[model samples]
Target: MKHIIPYIAIILLATVIIYSNAEKERTRITERCQDTFSDAIRTEKKLLIKQFCMQYRQENSPNSLSVEDKKDWYDQNYLIATSPSRHQLDSLFRDGAHKINRNISTAIGYTFNGKNYFSGDESCRKSVIPVQECVYRKDTISTTDIALQAYIHIPFYVPLQNTYTYAVVLMASVALAVCFLYTRRRKKNMTGIPLQELPETGNVTPVIPRKVQTEKWMKLTDGYQWNPQNHMIEHAGKTVILRGEALRFFQKFIVDKHFFLSYSEICRLYHLKEETNGAKDRAYHSIKQLKDNVAELGIEIKSIRGKGYKLLFSHRNRQII
Candidate 1:
């Protein structure tokens, strides 16, 4: 459990980064859509106005009119030509805007010749659209007399409907793969006979051969030797004196022939008051020092956290003598 925390944290961090980048890319795409659509609309308006002015000039024969009258005629014609009805604008948006960009969802609106027109559906017009990364573009259709305003809303990029499903499947696959590997590694590490399997009866101890007991030196499975009489432990050909509270704490394993010992039991054995300030800290320090001292012996003291400690030796029962 402790080993998997870092992996989970890394996966979470990667997910955050991926999501942030996706949003940024979506914003960039929306901005590009705004620029593209704005230009398209402006171009279309210009062409329509040019065509209207040509038709008006041909039909009205402005050469017979005064300067102010000619200005009024041009203005009225421009307004009449550019200000299409709401239905016409809606049809234009439905037919034209959707083809402009495949990634962006668009809505268009206009206030033309004192009339309002919208290209969005009823729900879109009524509901408040959240503006995160929303792109808005407005253009003015102007003649010498009047101007009509046109606006467009380009929403952030939305991926295909299947994208979310694929992402979920991919993430689940990765998590399952990590969990599978961790379980396999844990199972592999447990192949040897566990040192915790001592007899539960307090009166019996596991038998050690006569050669081991008579030699005055007991050899652990991993090649460490302990001499109880001399109070010395040797590991990897180096010997360290084992004494004081640490020695007493370790001696509990021999006395009980058990792997687990609670903190209260160790404190009682070592005559340390458990309620005293820094008592547990001192005990932890002693355990750490003991661990460092015995590292080369292939023996480990694992703290069970909120419980107690367990001793583990690397090899199986073959070298218990």
Candidate 2:
């Protein structure tokens, strides 16, 4: 669980980065399309103007129309040839331009002759380009103007279903590899012998007879004796009855010899809380009573002030048992 959290965070970070980059690319493409469409509209208008001028000149060459009349004719012809009504442009964009780039849809709008004309999807206005105003001029005289506004709508791309599956498989592989290596390392550190392959033979026990001697009593000093089986201590020919916490505390001193037993060790052995009410006082009282009980046997329990407690005894007084 601890190891999986970091991997999950990494996967999330990667997903965010991928999505951000994809959105940026989509925006860039939309902007490029808008610029291209604006140029196309300007180019188309210029062509229509040139064509109308040539036709007008040819038709009126014999009678020779006035300049104002030519300008009016040019405006009318240019508007008719180049400027489709909003409805017509909308239909064209929906059915024609939309098919050109399936990934990116487009919308077009025109302000021609002081009337607004718009075409294509209404929802695709987010990436609208600035209106490109194209003026029709002949010999330095302004005939008319048309404004083209274009919008390129690029939908965000999402990864296919296989992408998620691949990511899951990758994370699982990493987790399994880490777990396998950890288990191998742990097993390598273990100490053991295989018992299943032991040789089958008779006389597995030692053949030579050996003498075994057991001590019946353990002596702390010349006048003190301890009976392990009975759990009794005799001092100066008097048996001292010690039980429960006292007996456990005395057994620690016996086992550890002169080594200090810290207050924490004492608390753990006695199942006592170090921070409980009067816990230290209770421990001190118990030690005082134990010292009194074993005083006649030349044994003493000494406190090392803020450190711990230790049993004071001469090593030469140790019994065989």
Candidate 3:
């Protein structure tokens, strides 16, 4: 019984070693399966072979090119140049053997005796010229085979540790949410405040008061102050404060008590030319103010298309017509 148990253990160990080595060899074989054929006719066929070889290399790195893949490549590309006599290329496939370092003299190629299986330039050839060579690798066995190593993964069902990393992330998320809510509430609370109570920063401007004086036009020392509130010259209501110089010029040219003036004529009559920037700006402001304020005086200032402004106050049934 003891001897039988020892034998059984030995058999089991041998089986395990053999299975591991077979798996390794199969892996190596799969890797070595990548193939590339040298001579090809069509552009498409060449591209196809190149792509197939590349794909095999990518899939089975370190070692690629299997005998079957190599045979397939040759059959597919070679058919364009030469027709196959047999259904299958027996020389390339079928043999678990791989081609070694053999000089494929472009014209002659490699040869195997007795079997047409290894006859002719079994090597790759382009026309009568040898363009490239096809070299292959072989597998060799070692006496002392290594045991297969197993890789174990962490079990999904196991409980994970509560690291400070997860807790810190949770705390930061909560703080951010609270900060956003607080900011939103603050904005809502402050939106209702009136402008007067708001903080006064930046410039605090001083307010300048405008004083308007009244006088009669008859008495003149720079002409009576033009008052809109005067009773006699109800037309005074139509008067606006003009530059002291423009007012003096108007007094001199108060033609026949009612001189109709065009806006342009007024600009001309005053040798009161707007040569200076300040003078032109003031003149425009004065005229605009006169026209606007006089409109409220019940007196109509008429604009005659090609002509200009004429002032007329209504009295009796005649409107200074």
- The best candidate in terms of lDDT: 2
Give the Å shift of residue 183 in candidate 2.
11
Per-residue lDDT for 51-132 in model 3, tens only? 4332334455443434543454444434423433322232232121133112111121221121222223433322222221
**Residue 146 error, candidate 2, Å:** 4.6
What local lDDT does model 1 show for residue 321? 23
Of models 2 and 3, which has the larger lDDT?
2
Ranking by lDDT: 2, 1, 3
Question: Backbone clashes per model, in order?
Answer: 0, 0, 8
TM-score of every model versus the real structure: 0.36, 0.34, 0.20
Report per-prediction Cα RMSD to one decimal: 35.0, 42.0, 46.6
lDDT of each: 0.52, 0.55, 0.36
The residue ranges of model 2 lying beyond 4 angstroms of the native Cα positions read: 52-77, 80-82, 86-100, 112-114, 121-146, 158-321
Better of 1 and 2 by lDDT: 2
Candidate 3 global CA lDDT score: 0.36
